[model samples]
Target: MSQSHTAVTPSVNKVVLAYSGGLDTSAIVPWLRETYDCEVIAFVADVGQGDEELEGIEAKALKSGASACYIVDLKDKFVNELIAPAMQAGCIYEEQYLLGTALARPVIAEAQVQVALEVGADAVCHGCTGKGNDQVRFESTFAALAPHLTVIAPWREWDMRSRQDLLNYLAERNIKTTASATKIYSRDANLWHISHEGGELEDPWNAPTDQVWTLSVSPQQAPDTTEVVDLTFDAGILTHVNGSAMTQTEALVALNSLGAAHGVGRIDIVENRLVGMKSRGCYETPGGAIWYQGLRGLEELVHDRPCQRLRHQLGQQLADVLYDGQWFTPVREALLAAVAVLAQKLTGTVRLGLYKGNITVLGRKSPFTLYSEAFATFEEDEVYQQKDAAGFIRLFSLSSRIRALKQGGLQ
Candidate 1:
């Protein structure tokens, strides 16, 4: 059951809403004004979901009864500040999800708060439902950044429960909306990836239909011949795609096109949500997959065994923190600092072959690579004395040897 925040709400004269111009937010603009008798300002964060989602957003907000709408272009900052660091650290939630939706929230929420303060708004509202992780992500950020502002979550207050209810409410109010009841999937898209949830995904046993995917083609529908992509990285940040230099954002855009052509990134998983429930989702992240693979290839050459293990641990921890909306904390900064050190020598080029939803490493090269042909040679090598390994192995296994002797199992 959704609890009502308005039962004993604080007085609010103006409120800023994180609006998407979608159904929920479209309804929310008018609801905030009617329910609280406050001025509603629509705030849209453009994190490169696509031009289609952004087109006519301002007009939609105005039609929905917003006093004004502020669209913040967060594309550059999203890739450079959030995605770059996470990508460099190899942060993938639950070993599968690329943290696509999770990574976009903090930057969007931070920008929302900034808009709220700029307009002297008393409250900040979001259309996130109470059952999901986004409510926590958005409100947690608000609490950390602006503790004083009142937070209004309509899902926790309104009687509306379904998309049908939202539609009926809009109709009663004579407000126009593009949403329809037949819209089966719930999708969230940004620069890195697109996520699909709801509908048939509610049943874990069900396989997603072809309609669930919007970004990349089905592997079966992919090209017959393999396409090779060359990725160059400097200090663990993507610097170029193919032979042409590009900004990180531009490189990602190009990579997305190339990888998607061959069906390079697609995953379906049942993941544990931050709210303590298992939910199934499908994700398409062609460019991000290529980016991650390129960095990993570089790490394989540059990272020593210990550094490799430590980086793996860092990735898991950082993923957890980011997924749980803890990105604004000191612990995340500390983890990023460690990742920066590990990534310092990760300048490299990785050649990958993409074909039918697969990415194969064709070659990897790094200036700081630890690989030595002379030492690793199968033939006799003067640089490494194989005979000396016996004593070193004995020393390394001394603890095990002592444990066996103590148990009288030395034989």
Candidate 2:
């Protein structure tokens, strides 16, 4: 294997670790201290995974031999800064994934870097495996933000391979972890969505059982009645849901509750990973689905064909950039710049109906809409000249007509 080389010094006196209070990360603290003879400071980012995942996380990190722990609440930043702009741009990877895991990484890594700088640590660490995209995402952000800081990825360097091995390592050191060999699925969760992999998901032929899902119910189990919610957007920023003003985070939480009851946002896809491998994953983005539909519906009313095409192209490019962990690059900033200009006209309200894993555009209304009732109506309208379409169609098809005539004469 190639060496995990960085330009920093070989001797690291202190390091900051991205801790999840899980089996691998818990073991990593003691391993780092023992191997490097350094003080370990744990950094935890709360991106609204849940109260259960975060409960007593600081104490858990301390128990794992971390000298100190800093748990930063990145929930607001996650929704507002990362998710809101992506939603406005309508970014969905492979036409299905709402980028739940992809969107969370940069913000989390940014916080991790901040903690490292604040404590004057010479190194930063993460527990991501070598096979996953997260390793790229975490390391890329770290490289962009703090190049001088050493990166310690224990999974790439350590001898421990299995969950039982990590558990045994922790046990031997008198460290405790709540993980077991019986754990079925590998999962990542944030405020936007939850992703499931490993377990039965390794094989694309196998379908996910109810146990694979933690956030939403099965489509069959969803309520029979349809539910409608009105979303209001100001300059492409979501401001209210169902007539109540809300922040970006509040709107998503409320929508998730409504959509989960209707089994709205669940997708199973075999996507191409950035590491040049295909992996199967099941993602649940209940609220994201509703927001995506609402934004697109509102876009239709406000954007003309050329403007709409530009927005669609921007979405595709943004998805690729985000999935590849290139968020801090100039390419992403350019895409967002266009999205910002387009969003100035994207002020509207859309009512969406959710039922049995389906989202329907009930209605759309916008002050900036280019759709004029007088021009579109079948009834005679004074504003539009019906005779003008004759000349327009002739000019539109002039090239085709000329080509056909010349070929006919030649034949």
Candidate 3:
């Protein structure tokens, strides 16, 4: 229930900011320094938002009155540690969202906190708006990892109401900004996906136009020919793509290219935000979608019925935990432990056909597969007896039969 105009006492002499060099964060640098009379250090986490966003980011931070700027490359760690675990656990928030932006927040916050400690800062700051989930995500992380460090959320204290307000504020200070009020969308992107919000997206009834998409072509505009890509997994971790061995980052990058060509990962939904509000967004998660299909196919081949059911339960719990910004908690650790055990036998290969937003599983193979052709075959098999099915059926329905008899047949 935090508002954007809350008053707080300023006690910190230095603070590290989770800077994205965006309109909000750029303005935050000068605001924090002026309001608190404290030295501000910008901390940027390069979790593969792309080179264009990162280009000249340090210089921009410096130009915005930050005493120092630290841009840390976290792509490998992000994929291997955050995205991989979420993928293995089947963590899709609300059964449709990939948690792309949600997953990136913790890693970024952790890095920001690290920079704060290293630089001897008394507090950490972020530009997350009070209405959004990122503010909770960032503050919760700061509380968990570095409880003693003061958390400064400028959006919760500043009087700026909109992007235009921020732009005007910067202009008044003679600070140049790339932001324009005419821009229609607010976006967040990383290695896994890109999410589009605001403008047309804020209206649930509005169908996103071609202009809304950046990562993939429209399904209607996709090529007619289907593309088949082979994915290999080792103990639930993706290891290869199309018969070529690749590192974790390399595999994801490759799959992204293939999935994007087919428009395989665009989703538009009205999701429930953690702050008890509904927000509409369009997400492009091409590589993540393909990777999810491959993992699911492999899981189906290896996991038994009970194990599969339990894994599904774990996945739901994990999704909520990750989405709610409880990453550094014991509940998350326990869920991850359960997922890791279930994923031990999830080694396999999956061949999928991607065509115009559709992913079709062509084939699946696993060394630890429990599928038995003899047991499941429709034809005569030596491993089973037809006569035994009668007893199983009777036993399986015994409770129902007893209940019916006790209640005088069909009553």
Candidate 4:
């Protein structure tokens, strides 16, 4: 209903859109052309979703009445700029999976805004539903980077009540779409993880059937044998796996392969959406589990307990902020600044053994490690003053002792 309200009418010539070639966006292209009488350009960001999703997308845009379609490959930039820093903070949404959708959105929206500027478009558009988090995500980036450009959200304007309504609207216009309401599931996928929602996933108690997953196989169906891989990090950037150097995209691909075979990551949770809705979704982050654990293990070797605690606390808050589409805010920048300081000496090698539904750290080593085997050994150690602990404990428990004594005297 909010989508029905007219945005401040502005003088506009052309609009650039973040197009996905999905049911919603497929309809949006024609709608924009008809309503505004302006040229429409489609912009798609390739963030490692898949070739199948990208194949023939340009033609689809043109058929839907676009002036031009620009598909930008942002895989390398995604992993290096957005994902790498988030990984360093150990950012995980709801303690389940890495923030895959949360991570990709800002970059995608940024690219769309860039295309708008490049094409000299006065307005931007997206097909995100008014109720969903994505509308907020795309619009927030637009507000931050391109405040002058007006945003056209077609989902808010159109009278399509449901997916069926949208399908019919497209059908009447002779626009082709493969999406169907019978599918019962809406999914978003990238290299980091895949998320599933709708149908039974809408109910909190309904168990997700194996059919919902695509990236990682079910743990029950995973291979019986365990697999081991080595990961090396320098100054918080993941540099190598098994002594082989790789680009960020390549390394994630390699790890995803290993993690998928062993069923290392799968999670179902009811998450708080940015729009004040609680939505139930299943997410699979196989390779991400290994990478997160590997980085955490290395951080343990370098940081003290308090620093690690601070990092984890910051990570939890950052995950929430990132999930809420607040990445453009100063809070996110400050969080990243703190993470950078914490990650300065996070240089290490971590060996992980992947087995059915498990990613275990097999071994860990670091040149800048603060762990000392001698000080930590159970066998009588020279570094620790055992007798001094008696005095320390007495001091630590002094308040408790005084409270008990006073209470007893009062009685």
Candidate 5:
């Protein structure tokens, strides 16, 4: 089925593939075995995409010609290790994307590499298309963690140009595939968010219809009543929701339900893909939006102006690094360390209101709050002297005054 122009050479005996039980990956299993003449092992990471996606995935993989299939549960690890740290640093790519798909790539790649080693596979493979960012993300991880293992990207070698080509190839080979040429959207989902692409979304001017959305209702259809939630964070980690202590995964699931009920987070943007193309995508990140707002509220209460400025800089840098698949590098580690220091005092509780795609901070309190009521009072108070501001203002503007005088602009 593969139309590789070059002469076929067997480079490896076995390969561990990053499989998702999807059409591309299902076709990839048989293609790898037939082309490479090697054993194929499938690796699946469950980052809480939901039970429907994972159910019978291993069986499907085995039936697709894989010698073995590994389905690892990465939900808690994903939320705690990847999602939590990114949230703390406020790492949103291009000021809009929550880095949901970007963040999950490295975690999935790392686990895939581990499975490859455990199974004694001589190489690793992925189902990512040549034009997408996941290819870079997966290969970069392979280059960092295990350079000795050969990396096989089938899409680069295969001549399949479209979804139809893949389906036809599989059909010719008598391999069953659930995907069809009429599929409207390409979707990727995890615990953090769901990303939708293709179909009407390819044209940026086209508005997404109701069928395009899965996680949340339309803002117009959202309930009229406002919902309030209490979130508690300790040392940059979300610890509780609405007076109940919970694990990182539990809290996210709870917040996702609440936020989705009110249509909290939905973004549609044309993003710059790592492959030098612009792609249109819509994302639903309900729980993540609420968490970001709550943490920002606490940050305002605790962090000073200088600290906040530096944190903002760190966030931008972290966003780029994470998006570029440089998570395993020293620069990412350094940035995370800096963010950790800034988040040391970010412990507090924040009450937030959710209504029709809006998140508003109702109240916030922190033990390390820098707000001083006496110094900030509008009425006359013993702690403040009104006349002191005259001298302070004069000194602050002295450079401007001197410049004006030298230019003969002031009498």
Candidate 6:
């Protein structure tokens, strides 16, 4: 039987929970009921994890004593409003996976807040662990959107020590769970990418096993043939592929098919978590991988070197702040402003080669491109300024020469 709730209890009349139908969230249902003596309204955000994951989520929530279950379909909004903007900015963490989970939080939290208002709930709850980045993400959104609602985080209050303990507790309470005692990996999936943790992935040096990947094939196992893909962008937004216009979601789906077949996007990194720990994870972001590279190619055609460098630097900083879940801050707004200006002229076409997990930019062109053939050609041309390089090189090396002279030439 599940133990009775004893930790911090809510005095509110009703609570809206961000339910996922997962092990932790399933346990949260009964625990919330017993502790708060309040009606629980479960809210599930469907952000394209597929029907299998969401099929019986509402039923499961109701079975666990929730007064009602609300499953909001946020797939279109998620892709257009959230994913598209991040893609335009070419945002990725550690030069690997797009910040999929991190980006999903704000939208999910927003939906949860709306549900809370619709159901007249006085509080909101989530299943995020104390050590995870999601706690910050969800809480920050709540702080920004519905600060009046009391925030309830079960992980910080529950005495559950492990997944095993949760299972045992649920079993004792006759709460059936499909989760087994020995789960080899912990995964978080969405339209963007699938993340793998635990098992071999927890060890930074260990190579990911085949069983760990659910999305893309291993590069070694990819086909021997190469594939070419063409992409078009307009005002920092992806539009056409191979002369066919596609919706944002459709474009991602097509890119994912091509990129995954070529083993294009797989990454393993030890990333710093918001909880002050470095966790190793393997990420597969096939579609996002191709899109980001393609966007950069277009950006390169239009933006000068100095501007590109500044934008890339800003991207790195934005990655850290986004990963840390500071999405509502003024700093984030300033960073996005910089990215918007940099991406304004990013309109062009990019041809890419995909072979055995490698995405290589073959060609890129743009109307606003700064590249000049007359100035770059090897043959003598009217625009040639060969003698001007002497002055340019001297000015560039002026600081170095002064530093050497001040240091006694060779000290």
Predicted candidate 3: what Cα RMSD to the true structure?
A: 2.1
TM-scores for every candidate against the unseen true structure: 0.97, 0.96, 0.98, 0.95, 0.98, 0.95
lDDT tens per residue, model 6, 12-103: 88999998898989989888887777899999998878788898888888888888999998877888877777777777787775888887
Error of 3 at 89 (Å): 0.8
Q: Kindly give the stretch of ten consecutive residues in candidate 2 with the minimal lDDT sum.
A: 1-10
Worst 10 residues of 3 by lDDT: 1-10
Name the better of 2 and 5 by TM-score. 5
Go through the candidates in order and give each one's C-alpha lDDT.
0.92, 0.91, 0.90, 0.87, 0.91, 0.85
- Model 5 spans with C-alpha error above 4 angstroms: 5-10
Sliding window of 10 residues with minimal summed lDDT for model 6: 1-10
Error of 3 at 289 (Å): 0.2
Global fold similarity of model 2 (TM-score): 0.96
What is the overall TM-score of model 3 with all chains considered together? 0.98
Q: Model 4: residues >4 Å from true position, as ranges?
A: 1-10, 409-411
lDDT of 1 at 149: 97
Give the distance in Å from residue 230's predicted Cα in candidate 1 to where it truly belongs: 0.8
Stretches of model 1 off by over 4 angstroms after superposition: 1-6
Better of 4 and 5 by lDDT: 5
Best by lDDT: 1
Q: Is candidate 2 or candidate 4 better by lDDT?
A: 2
Candidate 2: stretches off by over 4 Å: 1-9, 409-411
User: Judged by lDDT relative to the true structure, which candidate is superior, 1 or 4?
Assistant: 1
- What C-alpha lDDT does candidate 2 achieve relative to the native structure? 0.91
